[model samples]
Target chain A: MAARLARAPGISLQHSIRHAAILLVAGRYRDTDRSALCRLHDQLPQPRATAWWGAAPLTDVHDPVTIAEGDDPVPQLRRLDRDLLRGARASEPDWLPDEPPNAWRGKGDHGQGGKGMMGGVPYGRPMAMMGEEMRDGLMLDAMTVTIGPFLRTLPPGLSLELTLQGDVIQQARVATPAYSASGIASEPLLRAARILELLGLPDLARRARISAARGDDDEGLVAAARRRGALLALPADLADVRARLDAALRRGAAPDPGEECLVDRLAGMEWQSALLRVASFDPATLSRIAPAAEPEEGEEEKAA
Target chain B: MTAADLAFYVLSAVAVVSGWRVFRTDSMVRASFLLMLSFIAVAAIMLMLAAPYIGMATVFMMAVEMMVMALFMVMFMMNPAGLNPMSMVHQNRLSIGAAATAFVGLTVAVLFTDLPHEKVARQAPVIRDLGHELLGPSMLVFESAGVTLLAAMVASVVLSARSGRFGPSDEGSRPPGLEPGGEPAGRVPESEQEDE
Candidate 1:
């Protein structure tokens, strides 16, 4: 899916949803993530189109065109783009309401302002709540945000709620585990291509993707990829991912990743490093390493 | 009003609103952004006052600084997203008094004091002149400050390193296979776990 979208001529894939004109949802999604997907759809600026390929559509998106198996969605997507760009097709209307989630228009009585210190909810999005820092017991504003399922950096269907402290992840929870990457995209070359894409080595990434799509083992190509320093540039924690890709290339076999504790691995890691660690593992491995079972009563507070 | 005057007023208004929003907004993330907005407006004012380099520098530096601030707020702040209305204040009355006092002092100084200035003969190469002044008699001071900044940067990197702080075990120990010492750093060896 990524290979097709990436190789698509003149239809650049935007990393950020804010810049996106269309939401190309591929594969299946967790029913629980319906609200999140809707929020993502609404987040795109006005006149956005959503195309669901081999996936069910939630009612949040209006007039979504579902692409059947073996159908070329590129033409439909191009037409949608052309229409939207030329003002021939009216831009898709917003599915979500325009108003704030809560009633926040009331004025503050005293200078104390709103609910707490900052004037409460001048808009719909509520302010972050306080939490103690994990590194030190010192209290700080802990920003909790749910990222992905759709985020570029994350594996699709993998949703995480992170409590962060200044680029440091104080805590991380896998709100939704990642699904196994579908189709031949999970081939070692495609996987390597995806990793290269994440590493900002786009030329090598495109080569790997295109080479993989051709459906043959090219030892020289893998050697060329390695020569490009894409594998070598990875941090130490990502060595396992590199090894897995290496093993898959050598022996066309899937390595079973043993159960690893997600929080233990992610906690105390900076955001970039955490992202690298997450991306290092194949989707299957990542899914197997479920976020640690919710702590028991005594351990719950400490976990939080 | 002339375009220049109009631009100045519009920029000033933007700066003031952003400045006010910085303290008023509950969200730590939003506050950081508002602060950036204020800085950008101030930078534009600097540009209008004929300091293009300083203005652009201010814009670049403040943008980076505010991004870092937002990251910090996201990490360390109690409520960066501001889901709940938060009071990011303490000693409110004292803060109000201090702010008011500073405002009065600044206003009085600006209104009542006589400022002396003479047009410089060669203002075109002001940056070059400033550079020369720094490298000439002030070179020692400049070098000393640079060294100090370098040391601080080194110190911060060392302190913030994941492996260095508190204890080595604070971070996960290396796998037995990865390490050269033929021993695990902290976690139980897989061989030992298998036996147990």
Candidate 2:
């Protein structure tokens, strides 16, 4: 369904909510994800509308545009976009309240807060504290952030609590396991296409997607990707990733699920590389490898 | 005032204001880019002062430098996007005093010093002259510096590589002992020692 949307000429799928005009809620979401969904809906820029594609609209959403299952959402999306621009349809109001998540509590007159520049939670969030880095043992500000469940880079429905210093992920903890992959979603062609998209080869990714949709075994797709230097684009040290990508393109059998935990493998890796490595695994394998922790109270876990 | 003189004043104001904003902005990324804008304004002033090569070079160099600086800021700084209004400045009294003194000293020097009045012809090959200056009299020095930079780049790449000539660079690789193999020198990680 996502591939069909991507193929549609008028409907451009955007990764960031800030760039998108319409919030397309697809697939089933857990009850716990309601707040996160509301947050995502609120994040879209003004003059926006929410369209539910084969998914139930949230109870709070007013006058929702719900597309029936097995129906193509492209035409409806186009109409929604056109109506938005023409002011024919009223824009959806923010689902979440327009207020800061945390209250301001600063010490000084100017709300300068904190002691000496490093010791305050100005807006309920603590400043990134200094911690020793893994590679060289340099003291750097390490930030803890919860990413995904909806972040386009990683597998859908997967969420991680990451401790980061610069671009490098110092530590990673799986907060939510990814959705179970349907047979179609786990197909090798689509899997290969996902990696190619991350590698910035959108043309090749499109070709792979088209091939999968057509149900035609295009042997030359892998060769063309190789010709475009896809393997070389990955870092040499990421040989495992390169091998997996090659195997994916050839529609090879799934690799043996490794003994090491996914979180352990992710640590000490740069964020982009770590995301790519995570994407290399099929969803079922990913869930098996990444032991999920119970979602902590107040942790923002977005709907996939 | 002539148009050029008017542009000079405007650019000078922009440069100074942006430079001031660099310290005032809460976001580290915004501060770096503000500094870049300040540099660009100064570069435009340089162009108006009839040094196109230097002006253009300054614009190019500062753009790249500030981009890198912004990347580092996003990586290292807390609250890089200025979501929460936070103060970027520090050392309030001392920094203010130092900045005021420097500004006064520079202003006094600018007002009193004998300044160069000579101007290069508009059609003169300033870039060519610069190229000649760098490659002729200072050829050896420039070439040596370039070579040194290249060497440093290569050495850093080699040192940072995870895979080495013998094996995985990070896997149980230890520095040799000062004497024989009494013990591997430096701080061996407790984890690696435990593995042994």
Candidate 3:
């Protein structure tokens, strides 16, 4: 359904959450994912609306346009966006309070300086401290930043805190496991379409998306897809899995075994490659192999 | 002042302010971008001064250089977004003294220097002569600089390769980073009997 939203008329899918006007929460998200959902909502610049389609209402959103199962959300979503843009509907206010994430103000009466050269809170953020450089122990600053859950690069609802050096991901650990997309997870063609999209073979990805939408025999589409070197374009390991899935989808065969845990596969890979690897897992395998969506008791509130 | 004079004044002012911001701003990414803005302002002044070739090169080269610098900033700099105000500075006394000394030196140099008189028509010819010098006896200097940069590039690659760029001792790592490339999990392209 999310796939079809991109192809829908009068609607362009926003790859960056920053650009999106209407936040669409489709399917069942983890109940405790409210903070993340709120964080994503707050990320959209002012004059934004959220559509909670077949998902539980987040606490931060006082009012949301809700869509029932079997109903098309795109129309409702478009209506909300249009209304907000036209000023007919007031843009939803931010759920999180307007304040710095932490008390970044400097300590002491003067508040001009700190231990050594760093005074307390320079412009409400601290100066970066040098750390062991990733390459050759040439001391460099090591920055840790969180990516996705709402980030367009990752599978929807998968967030990770990444330690990085320039373009290299030094360490990657899941902050929030991806929202279990159970409905599409089992469908081999749908999964293949997703991988194709990540592979930058969008035309073939589109064909796969179309076939997945139609939900019928895709033999002709598969034939055209193969001719386009859809399978050949992928790196060998992924290509092998994708070809197997594509053939299976064409002939209506059962899904092959999952390639396995995406975390290790994702780790050490750079941002783009990590995304590709995350998208490679067949949905069924991903759901099974991925860490459970529900967080350990205390970990829930600690996420933000 | 003439329009060119005014442009030079405004652009030079902006360049200096932004150059100051490159240090004053805490955000590494912002500082990198600020430096690009400063370079661009100076480049614009160069254009106004009739150094079109050098001006344009500065603009494009600085833009690319800043982007690469930003990438590295994100790569290595902790808290690249400045989410947390990390204002830790070391050797404040020395840094301030050095900055003051350099400022005084530059001012003195500018005051003492004898610059060429206004010769707009001759600017093109001057550039042409500079082009000649590149191919003339001064070629060794240019060649040496290129060799130096090439060596630096090789050195960085080798150093990073040993430490894995991500960290030390990560060998046989799969799905190598965006910058570094080695054998990334070889996926054998199996011929699947052309599924009938």
For each candidate in turn, the TM-score is 0.65, 0.76, 0.67
Worst 10 residues of 3 chain A by lDDT: A295-304
- Give Cα-based local distance difference scores for all models: 0.68, 0.77, 0.65
RMSD of each: 10.8, 6.5, 10.3
DockQ of each: 0.18, 0.20, 0.13
Please provide, for model 2 over B43-154, each residue's C-alpha lDDT reduced to its tens digit, 9 standing for 90 to 100.
9999887889899999999999999989878766766766456678889999999989999999999999999887778889988988898899989989999999999998
How would the docking of model 2 be graded?
A: incorrect
Candidate 3 lDDT over residue span B6-118, tens digit each = 88889989999999878777678899999999999999988877788899999999999999998888766655665444563569999999999999999999999998886
Which candidate number would show the highest lDDT if scored against the true structure? 2
Q: In model 1 chain B, where is the ten-residue run with the lowest total lDDT?
A: B168-177
Candidates sorted on DockQ, descending: 2, 1, 3
In order of the candidates, what TM-score does chain B achieve?
Answer: 0.74, 0.75, 0.73
- Per-residue lDDT tens digits of candidate 1, residues A53-91? 767778655567787646766787888777878888777
Query: Per-residue alpha-carbon lDDT of model 1 for B70-188, expressed as tens digits?
Result: 98777665546655555667799999999999999999999998875665443577678778989998999999999999999989877555445475433433456455777564455
Q: Which stretches of candidate 3 lie above 4 Å from their native place?
A: A3-7, A56-64, A97-99, A105-167, A170-186, A201-206, A220-260, A293-304, B4-196
